[model samples]
Target: MDCLTSKVQISQFLDNELPQELLQPLFYHLGECEECRNFFVRTKVVHEGAKNVEYAAVPKELDEKFAVLEMGEKNVSLMNRKFTISVPTAIYSIGAVIVMVLFIYVSGTIQEKQIAEQYRQTMNLTMPFSEISYDRN
Candidate 1:
């Protein structure tokens, strides 16, 4: 119904991928909006131009280089290859390790606090103030 939604649907309409239920609403919006209409026209023109473009054949030298590279890749044995870590993988591994360490430290601190609280409570119960007295003669 809106211009933005209509513009997105325009591409789907051009590709014949828009559903039957959505077609009328998009058409209505396109009829009312000039900017969307221009967008639809431009996209249609580009799509038609791309469709009319002829495929260029690859050069013989480039094709030969690719073949050599493919052959070299196939000849390499898996056992002789060295393993490597990608940048993203290394970063993520370090991040996970840091998170795990922080979790352990925080949990340990909390457990220690709980134990100290329990010890204070037990000592208070065993030595209540009312049970102690001072004698003077």
Candidate 2:
């Protein structure tokens, strides 16, 4: 198997879950390539480290917080209501949209004027050259 394919199967190979056909080729590639060997070593070290590490115990404070929150939830009533847009909020939203549209329009007009100026300058520079070419032809 190629190095790329073998790299993908490395974890599965360590766990003895890789297919039999790929096993020998992967081992051969790992032995021949120094980079792959180093990668394999790092992966193996990480795997072993993870396996030997102990999980921490949960804090007692978390249980107390949950108990207080459950008590609060029991005293609260769940409310279901339809959403409505207030007139002031709707007016502010419309004003924001209009400001954005005006900004875009002004910016676009400025860009268009700049592009036109550039085109005129290019034409002015090439006018003499065009006359010379026309005379030669």
Candidate 3:
């Protein structure tokens, strides 16, 4: 492995699923590599935060109103022996070789370094949706 530069995959690396041989190299790289270390931390925070996003509640009245739309048994027939393979189920299946590559192109080049770019790409991919708990008057 050429040490994945993409923060999304870096997250998976931090989770200890990467090969054992690469682990030492990754740790060493993170120790000395400023860009990678920053990426790792930012990606990790977003990944953890994603696990905590809560689903909004559906009002009881709305639930009752939509209750009639529930699927009826008569419309659905189940096989006596429950064993089948479906086409849609294979999405992102095992042994899938999906290689995603990232490239950086800069515009309006800066002469000096200052503030770091906000890690929106990594966070957007990692974190689930969260809304502010606003109180209205």
Candidate 4:
């Protein structure tokens, strides 16, 4: 087995959770790989040390504050909520924005076409006849 797999198995072994089938392979790998063996030893030491350490109890004042916060959170009901948007309202809002954008775009396009036509008409009226060409080739 690889060192990575062996290290994970080592942790599982210390926790007494390694599968029976894997135990022999992990032991064999640990016996051969010095680096993984050292890692396993260090992890075992830390795990044992953690088990021996004592946990302190929470202070009464802090516990009381947390209890008050929990009560406050639980007291607020779903019906007491103020603001919410329905699906139809959101759909209508999106549709209105799309319509407005299309209106503006179409109006701008029509205005540009009208301006171009007017410019062509003005040029036809102002240019001399000699400059006009009637070639069809």
Candidate 2 — which residues are off by over 4 angstroms? Answer: 62-137
* lDDT digits (tens) for residues 1-137 of candidate 3: 23454444476686767766766667777788778789888888987898899999999999888766664433453534467666666555432433221111122233111112234344553442243244796
lDDT of 3 at 102: 17
* Between candidates 2 and 4, the TM-score winner: 4
Candidate 3, which segments miss by more than 4 Å at Cα? 1-9, 14-16, 65-137
lDDT of 3 at 40: 86
Best by lDDT: 4
> For model 4, which pairs clash?
none
Regions more than 4 Å wrong, model 4: 60-137
Model 4 residue 88 CA deviation in Å: 78
Ranking of predictions according to TM-score: 1, 4, 2, 3
TM-score of every model versus the real structure: 0.44, 0.42, 0.39, 0.43
User: Which portions of model 1 miss their true places by more than 4 Å?
Assistant: 62-137
lDDT of each structure? 0.87, 0.82, 0.59, 0.88
Q: What's model 1's TM-score?
A: 0.44
Candidate 1: tens digits of C-alpha lDDT, residues 20-129:
99988887888889999999999999999999999899899999888987787767755478889999999999999999999999999999878876876878756544
User: How many collisions per candidate?
Assistant: 0, 0, 0, 0
Q: Please write out the lDDT profile of model 2 over residues 23-51, one tens digit for every residue.
A: 78888998898878888999999988989
